[model samples]
Target: MAQRSVRASLARAFLYLVLLSLLSTGIAILTLASSLRDAEAVNIAGSLRMQSYRLGYDLQGDRARLNEHLTQYNQSLRSEALLNPGRFWVPKEVRERYNAINDAWADMEHHIRQGDIAWYHDNIAGYVAQIDLFVLALQHYAERKMMQVVATSVVGFIAIFTLVFFTLRRFRHQVVAPLNKLMLASKSIERGKFAHPPLDTDLPNEIGLLARTFTRMADELQRLYRSLEDKVQQKTLSLQEANRTLEVLYSCSQALNVGTIDRHCFTQILQLVRQQEKVDYIEMLVGENWLLCEGTQQESVPWQSAAITQQDDELGQLRWQASVGSPPMPLMQSVASMLGRGLYFNQAQKHYQQLLLMQERATIARELHDSLAQVLSYLRIQLTLLKRAVPEENEPAQRIIGDFSQALNDAYRQLRELLATFRLTLQQADLPAALQEMIAPLRQQTDTTILLDCRMPTQALDAQQQVHLLQIIREAVLNAIKHAGAQEISITCTTSSTGEHTAAILDNGKGIASLSEPEGHYGLNIMHERAAQLGGRLTISRPAEGGTLIAITFRSSSSDNNDEK
Candidate 1:
């Protein structure tokens, strides 16, 4: 059978107790009834012996009452309640002694009735001895039966007590022990300790099942609590990251809104990110130039980086080194985007200003052409007339006149060149087209062969960069033709793998051996100034192959190199 529950077990224990009590009481009652019956039989036997004595006493006392005593004795012997010893739980020896007493009484009655006093007297001692023996037998039987009842009662009590004791022990171990464990486990749960003790399945009872259920509940709670905690922590981190990103964007917006976006402003932004990111180092760059740099990397791992860019202008990249799990990539991206917009705005303003300046230059060029060209032309004509009017015999005055004329011619040429430079504009959005236009007039003016070699990205330079770059090339080409008397000039424009550009003007000419010039020699100075405006490094030198090479190397003011590591 399946093991009982605690309730059933208790019920069973009570039932066992009740049954034991009933069995013990029954044995006691049976023992008591048997003792009572034995006692009654003993009493009956005493009465019979007393009656025999009374009959003898009556005959000795008075012969007139002899028949009455005999009659009483006879009636007592015939009474079944006194003589029927077999009806009680009497011993066989008791019944046999009673029967012998009955026979002796009958014999004594006959002697008394026949008037044999001496014979009756001689047999009366044996008859009384028989009655006494019968009485002793009945007493012995009652005492023995009573003793048996006591021994049975004692044995039953011991057995019942032993059964109840073991039953209670089973309740303590199986029911009480398991219940106590469950209570302790519940207390632990209340205190937020979800780990539980092992269930004792060895006991196949309801308490064992309860323990197993509680253990499962605790394990489930631990799992759910851990899961909930993890989710909450993850959400907290996400919120923290979002708040940090918002803070960065707010600062960037403030800078942009206040029009304070400059090198110092960007440096403050880098420090701000450094404060939040907890990194070993932080640096920002536009191509290779660092705008902001802070801290130092004492570790071997490389910094993670993100590009700062707008629609086309790549402002720079932001780089930082942090430990594992502490990355501010989203914040960095926001910073990049905000800074990129600021830089784009700055570039747009510059472009707008350059356009305005170009318009003014063009207007000035037109004015110079209208006023200065006419005056220089008239002066050249007058000098020619004065030279021709001078007499050939006055050689010294003729030579002076010729020198004056020559000087006027040179001034006119320089003025024309300046006007052409000012009038120059990009008719097409390409470097080659602008170069072709700048050198087209030169080809007609000089006997030089101009070779144009151009390799560039499709979306070349901005308007301001294009203007400065073209001016530098034009100055170099003019220097090669007019100053060096070069016969062959080649213009090359190309981009490097890093997206940096180089524009070179080469000439097969009598190379100038001197890099230094006297004061107010404006040719090289003008070219150098133009290169500076383009943010290009300019170099002019006699190549080993016997030619002057003027080269300007610079990167676009926009995009970063895609292959930058």
Candidate 2:
């Protein structure tokens, strides 16, 4: 746990190496210095033998210069290098040899001075041998000092190499390995992961602190990256949902805004909702009328309902079976509103078509009255005149003339009735309203109690269907008024779920004798023809209470007829 620094450690290692180097250098210097002048001392000692022989030669051959040679020999014996016994390199054997040589030289000198030639010659060789011993000692001491210097140098070099090897290993562990880890950690962070091994924060170096800081930074980055990923996923889901919602709304709007909106169109809209929203069941109801329905009802689930409304007018209720979660109310409401507008537009179109048809019928009636009806009236007048012009006694001709006149009158009356039927005035596409208007004028002509009941849906009939139905009802009512003389009359109209229409006129008057048409009356035949035009059959029955009941059943429009259009 010590606060060790890389710089300080390196500095200490360097200083230790310097000290080791200095110690080795000092030891080599001291070792080599001990042998200083030892070589010179050996040379000077070897020269002493030569100097002794020269002195002996002088004693034998040049006795005139004998003192001079003796002075030289004394100087060589006391030479500073050889005679310094206080020096550490100087050996005791060399010094003892020097003392013996000096004592023998003193005796030789005394003999030479006393003229003893025999003593001088014998001691000279012995003295030379002692000098040889001293020189050999100096040589051995110098060689030993050189060997010590070599050993010291070798040890110092090995120690320095060992310290360098250990120092480099420590540097690799503490510095290089940790820096490599940091590099790998940085690369992992770049790849959006933290996959590297843990760093050694316990290291006693600056790299340890740096590793700890980097780890915390990496942790923060990873947390932020995860949070960002979660947000992106949520946003993707939200956008997908919004896109589906838009698709549903756009499809529904397209279905409702077409030119001829029908049950099929609404059914398609319901299908769009089912496919997009995965709903269980859906249906539309206008009052008690089910306009369009899809899917089966599931009693286990509650129904979610929205009003089919337009401009504050709630035309119907749209209901669907959904699970526990609430359905999209706003989208449903928008579809319902579009349905309401479609219904409104459908009614308006029907009314426009009815108006056009009525106008065409009125124009045809005016043309027929101006041409055919006028011609028939003129023919009737001519027949009357011809009858009066005939002879009074001719009975056969009179009978023929009277029959012709009656036939003309009947044809004219029928023509007038047909014209009135064609000129049927209508202000709206409502069948019920048209019925009421038709009955209003008849009510003024009859004191008979009359009742009307119409339960048919307004959208059940087309313009042609309305015309045929009204004509049939009028003929039935007129017949009841004219011949079924007794009392009450009732007109009832209804529609089935399968779009079949039924109209009945019941009377409480004299019952007809037969279903067959009477010879002179064509009203029954005409009513039957009108029913046929409606793509239906008519039934006439005499009730037991003595009244006639006339009823007609038909579809609003034949599929074959619509296909032709």
Candidate 3:
């Protein structure tokens, strides 16, 4: 391809050179032919002038001689007539001479009368002078013509030669030379050198076009090579990072297998994470309820269900609450979720574990109530009977009975409280009725005045959301009574314009600590967590007027809450 291109270029150059040479030669030849023709015409006029001058001079001499002979003939006739009458022979001689003279005169008169000789002699003289002038002009013209021919021939030769030389030289330098360089560069590129060659800059014609083409090709190749290199490097780095992550996952799985089901296992998991990956806080929760374990009390630590399922029914989630150098929240959730998928398929197992735990606690509470409480009651009765039977003098028996009765009463009370705690674990009841039930208990138990300032909407909440909202309100009210030292508490439930359900609990007492404390304020955190689990939010704020307000909000879907009639 390169050779063909080069040959084609050379051929074009040759054609151009030939055309230029032909044009130069043609112009020179035309000028020379015109000069030569002018020189011939000048030479012919000079010859004609010289001949006419000689002919005029000859005619004038002939006319002068003829006039002299006529005068001599007239003298001879007068001598013959005056001398003698008897000399006939002399007269005849004279007549014969006269006849010759007459013939001569007749010839001269005929010549003069014809006017050809006179005109010829007069014009010849004029032509002779004209010839002299013409000779001078012809000499000058010949000199100029010779000079012009020489000058034109020299200039024409030089111009043609110069045109031919430069044309051929340019053809070689422009078309052939650069094309040769380009071909060599192409061959080198084909052989894998990939080095760019210098382009010819001397020619501003077609060769310049070829050089630019080559330069563009080189630039494109360089760009493609660099792009491919970048892509390969990026892919390699990505694969390396992926491999490292997989290794970490494998190690985590091994550690899980070795650890136990207690708090120690949770600590071990946290330690492994801390040592392996730089993290801000790590927490391991046990059982379905995410029961807090010792050494995992950092407020910043995120509490998420473990990724691995503890039991067949319970799923485990591991979350990173914060990282020393990483961005917060949703990012952490994404990372934890990705890692968690390897351990647990879904959160259903976690709910199952929670239910099982609830069942177990209930069973234990029932056993304690049936057996331990009855025993304590029997003991108290025996102590009362013995105290009555003993005499007033039996002080020792009285004291022993009194001590025994007190001990039995304490045990009975403890059992009753445990039973109440267990009973509270029942599923959520109706909203208004459940709220009324909770308020009655509060009124009976504490001196604090509790008021329900609720404008219940015609709509109701979903079963799950209602349960969560009630739990959050219960926790808030209890916390207010215990911590805030509130004398009066107001609970209000309302619906928002967008069909959202809102419940607000207001306490007129010292506000709780800021919500920043994660573990210390368990009640608020639990409330927030429950709200979030039900797709709701809990906001706790203290007003400048010296009261703490806790509000819970949730969405009321048709399945969850009845629409307003």
How well is each residue in 1-565 modelled by candidate 3, as lDDT tens digits?
1433545755765676576567656666654554554445445444444434443444556655544443443443233222222445223432343344345435443554454676565444543454355435545544654575567666656765776787678677767778899889888876757775688744556567677777788778767876888899999998886665566555655554542232233345455555555665555332232322223335765544334333444334555544355433443343344334423322233334334545776798889878987888887787778888999799887887787777677667657755654455532233566577657776787899898865544124434455566667777787788779988999998765455778999999988777665432244555678888867788889989777999888765643232231
In model 1, pairs of residues that clash are: none
Indicate which candidate wins on TM-score: 2
TM-score of each: 0.42, 0.54, 0.27
Off by over 4 Å in 3: 1-422, 425-429, 518-521, 558-565
Instruction: Name the lDDT value of residue 438 in candidate 1.
Output: 70
lDDT of each: 0.74, 0.80, 0.58
lDDT of 2 by residue, 1-565 (tens): 3378887888998998999899999999988776676777778778777877776777678688888877877887788767466555466776676677777778877887776777778777776777777777777767877888999999999999999889989989998899999998899889877767898788877788778888898888888988999999999998887787789989988887777665567778888987778888888787553456677789899888999887898878889987745557877887788888877787777778778888998999999999998899889888889888999899999999988888888788778777877888777666788889888888899999889998766665666777778889988898889788958999998867566778999998888778899766688888899889888999999978779999999876553222111
Q: Please, what are the lDDT tens digits per residue for candidate 1 over residues 1-565?
A: 2376777878888888788778877877886775655555566666766776666666667778878777777776656544475666556897788678777777787877777767867877778787778778867776776787788788878988898889879888988887888888899888888766766755777887777778888888877987898799999999987887788678767766754344555656766777766777877766442345667775786778888898866767877887755566777787888767766665455455456757877999989988988998888888778877888899999988887777777777777778777877554444566578777888998988999987754233566677788788888888788777888999988777676888899998999767865343556777778878877789979998887999999876544354212
The lDDT leader among the candidates is 2
lDDT score of residue 195 within candidate 1: 68
lDDT rank, highest first? 2, 1, 3
Give me the displacement of residue 239 in model 1, in angstroms.
Answer: 3.9
Instruction: Assess candidate 3 and give its lDDT.
Output: 0.58
RMSD to the true structure for each prediction, in A, is: 35.8, 34.9, 35.1
